[model samples]
Target: MLNLNQDPQIILWALTKDTYWHPDDHWQAVDRRCKELSTGEIFAVIDDIVHHFVHAPVVILTGKNVWQREDFDQILGKMAPILPSAIALNNPRLSHAALLSRWKDLGLTSVYLRLQNPRTLHGRQTVALAEAVVDHGMRLEIMTAVTPRTLPWLPGLADLMLSVGAASWQLGFNESLQRSKLDAKTLEQTLVWVADFAATSPLRVLPIGAPQYQRIVSDRYPLLDAGRIALREARGIAYINHHGLVYPGVNLPFAGGNLRQSSFSNIYRESPTFCALRDPRPLEGRCGFCDYHLTCGGSRTRAFRETGKLYAEDPGCWNPQTA
Candidate 1:
């Protein structure tokens, strides 16, 4: 029984300061990029973009600097009022007990916690964390770098499994990037390992990795396809973070070309999930071919950058070249 009225699930994964090339420029960039839109538009853009990718019922915000919880909260507070329904919190920084407490206070529906460090914890300590999560009525999503054999050692734990970064390549790729990485067989074996342990336990086993690996999974394993998986298995969800230009309808950006044109309005509408930062009316009568025409408020930034207008063709649009 799927709940149609429920808001779509989204996951906003911000890069860590170290990983972000222009850490100091983020706030300014965000403001500049979204300046043309209103609060509603911002929410719509984010919602649409996320919905386009994974139609999950839960959204998770990842890659926050938990060490600066106060700073993180401050930034989130500013964004929260607009995206009130969003469950915004630092990534798996708090202890299990602290996490439970925060989840309750924040009215969070789900949380993604990193379990990488716990592999070194004593058996008792690990058990305590696991027990606290289950007992506290908190959904435990585990992100770890440990091998499959060690997962069962923390039995009756981990309702959701997430593999991050390099560890993901270990899960599998359509084509191995390097010989050191795990092949499809190894990845399937590992998933089977976790699936066997969770056996009808209502636990979801997901391998969260790079876009390439995610695409491979989505293509190979039906269960790994976010939309299809969510529709079939009511248990858990999967998300793929890929970088691609979206256009109205099936108009993709020029393939294998550097000069791709896109329209601001089309991108917003094509985005599976996004938040609109402005009103939708300004884009009417623009981009005539856009099937989502009237409602497809163009992307202001993309439009201006490409054509110096708020309702022009996206410089990334590839329909002409393809035709």
Candidate 2:
């Protein structure tokens, strides 16, 4: 029953993600697990869209510099034949990208570049890199962090994304304690701008996390069913840290299970903590009463961040009751 066809999301820890990769025996075991997962020896079927399997298998490298680091390059080279992971690289040296030539041969189907402000120097490099990714016949995406300073630039950024032919774009607000300091007006303004821009733009632009939760609760966005939302975060998504600690999402305090203790497919399907997060009946506040409550219960991570409980409604939501 540990089949990956049901839910497939893999975040392969890279050396660049704050964790050191030592070539020790434990490291060898981790590598072996990765190979098995990549080669389908660990599960019945891995739903990878790159291989045209199903609606899942969005495997990401979880860090940048994969192209620059020799260790990652060696590991990726070995798994390239069967795995074909899509990489998300941060601030890349786009000018000297001879690596693009090997992308197809190495089974790298797409590249997602995370850019900050479009007006900044690093942002310009992002656009150039996006164009290069497209020219290489690989899919490209642009993800920008939304801060108070970065808010006003999104309109121009949307145009830039369209110009570069990126497949999608995301405006991800900070999810940590900084969210508390963020002006509510700025957050709402950013949401409205994204809602309006997405309506007009051919490029797929989306607001992530709390902004998105706001949209769903305020009837600006579609309400997802419990099953869909459950699979998406409560169960479907997996953020395995460099040490292979599997959490429901990024920077979460708890782990559903560790990949070292069980097969990834098994842990994703049957972890008690993850399963508890899926129950939609006991959702609190206005989120529990709204018919869409099952789908849009607000940001559970933000709930935990603000209220110390994942089941608590999001404090970031304008209505303390609505979140």
Lowest summed lDDT across 10 adjacent residues in model 1 is found at 250-259
- For residue 17, what is the lDDT in candidate 2? 44
lDDT of 1 by residue, 1-323 (tens): 33311233332333222122221355335424532223343345444444443333444444334324334454343343333223323333235456466544455434444443344554345445545655666565554543444434434334223212111111211111122244334554444554454334344554432112222334355463443322110012222111222211111121111002332234332333222222233443333454333222233333443355544533322222221
Off by over 4 Å in 2: 1-16, 19-54, 68-84, 177-180, 211-232, 319-323
Measured on C-alpha atoms, candidate 1 has an lDDT of 0.34
Residue 38, model 1: Cα distance from true site in angstroms: 12
Model 1 residue runs over 4 Å out of place are 1-10, 15-56, 66-102, 117-119, 122-130, 146-180, 194-199, 209-323
> Which clashing pairs does model 2 show?
none
Best by TM-score: 2
In lDDT terms, how accurate is model 2?
Answer: 0.59
Model 1 CA lDDT for position 41: 37
